[model samples]
Target chain A: MRNIIVTGGSRGLGLGIAERLATDGFQVIAIARSQTEVFDAAAQRVKAAGRGALQFHAADLADIEAIPALVKAIRKEFGALYGLVNNAGLGTGGLLSGMNDAAMAQLLRLNIHSPIALTKYVTRTMMTQKGGRIVNISSIVASNGFNALSVYSATKAALVGFTKSLARELGPLEITVNAVAPGFVDTELTSGLGEAGYDKIVRRSALRRMAEVEDVGSAVAFLFSDGARNITGTVVTVDAGNTA
Target chain B: MTSRMADNTEPSVRSTILDEIHRIAALHNKQLAPLTDALPLMESGLDSLCVAVLVASLDDALELDPFAEDENLAFPVTLGDFIQLYENAAA
Candidate 1:
């Protein structure tokens, strides 16, 4: 079975993606600082159902310098990484003026630097193996923009460029790179909006409902599937037409 | 620690660069002409992406990238100059 790495897989959308991919029969190695009970349960579900296995590894992705070693160690544990989900990121929302220097620095480090550095090492393995998939978890706010998310949006927007350029760079090796831009999903990441805020968003969406974490997960899984082999250098927006 | 040996001799460093050029070429399905010290990297059949992979892999193997530390360093054009850059950095 092909091995995949899902960063931030302890909870939220990352865990959802891990569960979905494991259920779809890809050995998923979920990298997070700590494993959650919810993540453990999902892993158990996949295993008990005789689906692909879901396992966990610990890493602080914010430390960009340590990423090369981290990728090396993970590759040693799980042979020939077939896919990477750059899902670990901070959604610290704040207006650009009020955001302190430290907060801005922290946001850039985790949101932008970590994924790019991680991809650098991961793609080495992929380039050698001659085929792989990379799905970067982007936010719908990246394109449409949102209140109090100027810096966050910029970081996510950077991933769109990262995804497109990397897709072109690695295309010759048969590696596919894509991004999934999800609208406000029902995760803790969006819980800050609370029920009323989500309801307001739901009313605005053409679907008249907020997207579930599973929807984002399915989009990522689809990209890793054979059906998306030819799909590269594009952003797969999963916002349920909220942007539409 | 493995790179410590390359610090002892420039030839060993050159050998590492040559081996990596071959490995990267094969991985990308590019056919490289026989390597020589005078061969320009551009003529080696490895495109920019492959050259990037080669540089990154060498940095990992040697644990030192002179180019990363010095922005003003002249970009190496020949296969020999690339190996020398790493050897000098290791020294």
Candidate 2:
């Protein structure tokens, strides 16, 4: 079975992707702080698959210093990781003047630094094996540039750049790096915004509705599939045509 | 200590949890406002890092596993909401 590691697979888009991958017969190892919930969800996904298994690990993605150790642990547990989805991230919004250094640092650590480090760590393994797939969860704000999410957008934009560069570097090794930028996915992260907030977002979107978490999950699954072997370094937008 | 002694001290723990929530809120550049017991944490604009920090701090201050389970404890939007979770866990 092909083994994969999905960071932040406890809930939201990560969980959705994990579920889809599990159903597709991949050995899914989900990494999240809430091990119990993540494992439970993974268990359900594996059961739904009927041909795959799931493993859960508890780790804080914001602990950038621990990323190497995390990859090592995955190596020990899974032997070979076939795919990695950098889905763990946080969205903090404030004017540059309003955010303190610590807040900004925290955002960068989780959203940018950790993903970069994890990608590098995983790429080494993938390169040795000469095969793997990597999907980064970016945001529409990466290109659209929202007002309150300047820092968040920049971090994601950096991921897009990293994806393209890494794709070029790793193309010969048969490793593809791509990003999926979801527009207004309905997940716990955005659930805080009530109906009024949803309406506002929908109004701005060409599709007149926000993308479901599953929408992004399907796109991520496609990138990992054999069909996407020739496609790399591309940012696939699943944002309901908001960026159109 | 007897039941009465513990009962008398309950409010102190509650107060401490409230203070910690406010501290965390301030760290996120949010003002400490009157929060209800059921307000969702994200509604107040506390992002994921703040939630992680709050969980870590609660773990240390209360000396209990606040996230003993993986259930999403709705972000505490109000000081009271934060206190209630601590009180429940500490109890």
Candidate 3:
């Protein structure tokens, strides 16, 4: 059976991606810092689907040193990796000037360093087998500039560059690397926007609404399927035409 | 060649791979040096971008992955080695 790893799979977009992939029959291993109620329910649902296995590992992604061990555990259980989604990331927005050193460091660690290290470890496995799919969760801020997300945007943008370069390097094998850039989504991250902020976003968007988690999740699931076999090194915008 | 072996498919895996190489190079407007067993691919005008597309297209047609199950794989450096890489896996 093919195996996939979705980081930050306990909630929001990560959970959505995990559920869709599970429904599609790919064994999913979700790595979240904690096991929340939603995660347990989703795990049960996926297992009940009986199409594939569902497992969740609790670990802090920011602890980069723990990555190798996590990969080892995945190999022990799943044998090989068919897909990896670097969906574990932080969402922070503030003017660069106001951002403190610690916050910037933390953001970089979670947003970029951890994913790159995980990708490195997973690619080592992918190289030894049929290639796999890597979908890095990015944001519209990665492409377009935003007022308070200077550092956050920079981190997201870094993944775009990394995706393209790695896609070419791994093309000879079975693997493909791509990114899904989502605009504002109605997850807990955006829940703070409240009525007025959401109204502004809805009005400015071409689709007249914020994205749901499934919207981004579906895009990720596509990249892992044969339909997107020929797609690589490209950022698929999942935002409601906001980035369009 | 035995009749039993000939029934697998037409064009053979070897020719298929060669055709794909030429096709990819042509599609990308890359001027690969004259095909040869000893020609180094790096100097053959096949840029990194071209190689990426070539590998993906070839992988689509020929599913054999030489590097699979072995990370220490000495990746093919020449046209012959590259062809042999897939052929070895197929065998």
When summed lDDT is taken over every stretch of 10 residues in candidate 2 chain A, the lowest stretch is: A121-130
Query: In model 3, what are the clashing residue pairs, if there are any?
Result: A128-B68, A128-B69, A131-A174, A131-A175
> What is the C-alpha DockQ of each candidate?
0.35, 0.01, 0.05
| Docking quality level of the chain pair in candidate 3 | incorrect
lDDT sort, best first: 1, 3, 2
Give a tens-digit lDDT track for model 2, residues A106-173: 99989988989888777766654568999999999899977678998999998999999989877866
- The positional error of residue B74 in candidate 2, measured at the CA in angstroms, is 49
lDDT of 1 by residue, B15-91 (tens): 67777788888777899977887889889898888887787677656666677579799889998788788888888
> Regarding TM-score, does 1 or 3 come out ahead?
1
Predicted candidate 1 versus true structure: per-residue lDDT over A125-172, tens digit per residue: 777567899999998988996999999999999999999999988998
In angstroms, the error of model 3 at A136 is 0.5
- Each candidate's fnat, in order? 0.27, 0.00, 0.00
Candidate 2 Cα misplacement greater than 4 A, ranges: A36-39, B1-91
Q: Which candidate leads the pack in lDDT? A: 1
Each model's lDDT comes to 0.88, 0.78, 0.82
**Best model per TM-score:** 1
Model 3 per-residue lDDT at B10: 52
Question: Which pairs of residues collide in candidate 1?
Answer: none
